[model samples]
Target: MAALRSREASGVPLAWLIEAVTAGFVDADVSTLLDEREERTARAALPPSFFGWLAAEARVAQAIVSDQNEGDSRVPYREVERAAARMLLEFAYRLMHDDPDRHFLDLPFRFAAPAARLGIESSLVIQAVRVTERRWVDQLLTAAGERAGDIAHSVLSASAAIYDAVVDSFVTDYVVAQAQLDGEMLATKRALIDALLKPGVRDAKGFDDLGIDLSGHHVAVVLWHPTAGIGPHLDTAARQIGMSAFANAVTVVPGDDRTLWIWLTFADDPPPAVLERVRSIPRDPGRVGVAIGPVARGVQGFRRSHLLAREYAAVAGRLPPGIAPDIADTERMSYLSLLLRDPERAEWFVATELGALATGAVSDRENRETLRLYLETGQSLADTAERLRIHRNTVVYRLKRIEQAIGRPIASRRHELYAAALLAHLLEQSES
Candidate 1:
């Protein structure tokens, strides 16, 4: 990139090129290339906001060249893309004026840092630049006519130099900014995560810098692989989850080589169907496990959601690789999560409350599930029978057996039995 800059510095100054292109040399009749009629035609061909239109076209072209449209549904210009396009347009117009910025080639530098922060690859910027250059060349050719050869030699040379300088600036800035992020931003994010986990730790400016809106609803998620390097898969999974939930924005923080903590922000809580879609990520390749927290609102929601996800992760992490659910969520696991917080006490409680019903025998498993459903359905035997697809008498028989194993009537300790049954089920799942 520096080589490109050095090469440009050694060539005809950009201001001189601009003077020659617009004012024309004494020998070349290039000034008359775009006569009044041709100018009107050119103006008619483009809308009033030609630069804006060109910027949008460049965005599309960049997306195609970057292969961002293949399976990804995100808009190409979602990042600091508009800024990049503006920089490109500014560069072109500056080339037509005599007083180009002393740091004209560094125009891309202003937007590059922000683009890099947004994870925009340098290649995409180069693609946009190439698109803008091509369009400019087409316009130049249309106006060239008989002076085509002279215009091509002079104007094309200047445009190529400008293109090279801008490309170098973007490439250079992205490299520096990304490197800085890898070192500094990682620590900053970790600090931010730590602060967010604690109560009453709010940094408005810091949250703004990281693009997190504390006022919006948030769903926290943790993705991990017990024995594999998460690598880029974590980011890809985060994107899939965000898109599925129709999140307005996503923020991901790498917790370690094997884990990523993510937050998806939305204007309001997504419907149940969207959450189901988020949970379906296990079907995708990579053997990644997702633990999602319930949707909550405001700063409290952000903190609560993340805390719940971490709790869910603790339980989900107990499952053997490939045995973890695609999505382990607080909605389904919060009760068990509380029980499992102290594994030893939880085990003793399960054993004592469930008695012989906690045994691994198939009969006991059936009895335990029947009792659990009986309690969950508001102690309605009919509802339990319907769910288990058994006759009401069968549910009655199971209840009797469950009571016999526990040495008490089911109604004597319904809530205790319910909690123990849930913990027993979780323990069974872990063992399996």
Candidate 2:
């Protein structure tokens, strides 16, 4: 029966098949889903590595059931936490069958033992499962595309049983495991972070315990590296930030193996030396990525600055390695990051705004630099020419070329032109 269902899924209409073949639909759905409150809650609970891990697990489960292979797929199980996750996912996939083999029913028990030892909270486990279920439903519906409305009910109906069984069994086992270990610290951190990030009243005592003064100015910084073993490096960088500012900073792991959330607090706005220290953090080994948010004051500022840091981090992740630091606190990046939340949209905007110059050829890049400098210097031809060490006629000539490519007078769409050119430069840098 499972085999028949799997075949039916694969043998869908051509359009459906086309949509299903690429993971882009799933990626898009996941991105959209992350914007929701519940998804954000779950995202906050897990580490930055969770999304990539979940995607890999989904692929492995799909491979197992579709191929009817009891043996493990190629996904790595080096981490015990992920090994437990894989087992539970496999059990869920099996339950989709009319007569699932009962042997794998003990999977929840297996997951509980290690989870308890690792001090994993039951609520977090449930939230993770719930988020995964959401993704699964979205993947099915997205693959259906135009037929999504037709199959949405059926997909939800079929997934309900699997989700319920998994949750019930997990909660039951987790209750038993909780008696054996204390995960109170993890729970406390999770609650504190939720309160800090979410909209509502906050407990001042919580901040007091962490030595964070809510009334002080804060500059949020997010540091992450591709590899998991960079925790020590991140710690060193965080300390350096505090030292450079001659102030205190609070750092949170946020449950991610590869990321750190930090807020450096000051009695006043950070001075030039502190900003310079932040800009130099990327020079550290391990290729650590740093995103520094603007300095702001009080509780609201703390939250807002962290949010901005997350946004900056998102934009930085897309840039080529060597240039991420150069964009930190740059006037152009601050302006462009606000508008480039969606990469696809950014690409389209760039393509439309800078027709010929967007091609990223040598001549195109030279013209983009000329235009950027020209705008940066208040549209002064002399200043731009001097910056480029070229004749003023050369600057004017390049402006004419830019105007021709954008099909408008530069002054008419100066803001759009500047944004598009800057973003295009970064995008091209990333491509390299």
Candidate 3:
């Protein structure tokens, strides 16, 4: 039955075969359904080099990836001679199945486990996957005969979408595994601090090593989580999400047990999504204050960004207790951080920008709060009403009051920037 299916699928694109299976038009009988004889023949067709030779090629490929890594990363590649051969055989099986019902990724993560232990960049692990895929296709072309016609047909015709999904999962697994490896607690807090602060303070060692990626761009995150029952570790939550999102190790160090300092490093400028995560974190009731540093590189970049995140945390710390957890603008937080760094200066700026409305009095503060929410709701009257749980007419009333007091149209660009600055000041205020 399986052999009959394989014969019928001979020249069909893998996509169409998979679609037929998915659409319920065919029974994929993937688990041992395929003709065993044909599967064996396909695997047998590959040259000896595609298996044993594959390891040699992987070694060279891993070397190139290692060489291209950050200049200061002294990590060395572990040998994969035996493992690469296993991966080749596995790849051959995956290629021959070409049937959606029987399709499984069969990527060689276990083969790379040795290199993974050496602290090589996860990206390097991904590079090996590409190299393996390319090698498989090359061998397929050279050796394709009647037996491999289906394998050749699918692999060649729709290489892009087919391999994209494979690589995505492969890369996702590599980073998740790296996170699991690093999830084990690191060295003492004081030791990590000293290492990060003073680069040359004694020889660097494992876990104790300057864990920061000196040349990588980073988005530093700080979580000021509540210390009550053994609720979820905010640090762990951040690490898992960061690993999944950025596909790399996001350093999570305890700033004491109640506080966590995390850094997500990237090879280049982060996408908007990364910044949004940083901004959106430290959610409600948690007093989460997040600030992302500008993209920077090297040792200076590491310290500078950490300093910004820490400073951002301090600014959040000063917020009136129970202030909604929120992120200060990454772009604006640069100077705003400086202003809020000193209470008196922040007060002065608030008083200057907000004028009479800057006083911390209840009525003035309420007006300020409305403006903050009003801006946050994207200046939409309906959203502000819904968010504040007040009638839409109440929002209109508040906006009118606010504009009358501030003496400027809320829609003006200048007033908008001022309103943001005013909120920054309010974030630093302690609720009396």
Top candidate (TM-score) = 1
Give me candidate 3's TM-score against the actual structure.
0.41
- Lowest-lDDT window of 10 residues in candidate 2? 26-35
Question: RMSDs, each prediction?
Answer: 13.7, 24.6, 16.8
- Predicted candidate 1 versus true structure: per-residue lDDT over 1-432, tens digit per residue: 353344347553333332223332132221122335433543443223443444454455556544643434443344434444444445445544422442333243455676667676677667767776777666555555565675565556556766777788778877888898787877887787677777986545466556677888888998887668776667778778777777888878887778899988888777888778888754453467788898998878888998899888878788654545556797656865788899889889988999888788999899988988999999998999999999999998888888888899888999999998877776777777
List where candidate 3 sits over 4 angstroms from the true fold: 1-185, 188-195, 198-208, 211-213, 228-232, 273-292, 320-336, 352-429
**Candidate 1, which ten residues in sequence have the lowest lDDT sum?**
24-33
Per-residue CA lDDT of model 3 for 29-137, tens digit only, reads 2213123653345345543323334445456555655555653254433333223433444444444455423444344444334445556666665666567667656
Cα RMSD for candidate 3?
16.8
Query: To one decimal, what is the Cα RMSD in angstroms of model 2 from the true structure?
Result: 24.6
lDDT of each: 0.68, 0.63, 0.55
* TM-score: the better of candidates 1 and 2: 1
lDDT of 2: 0.63
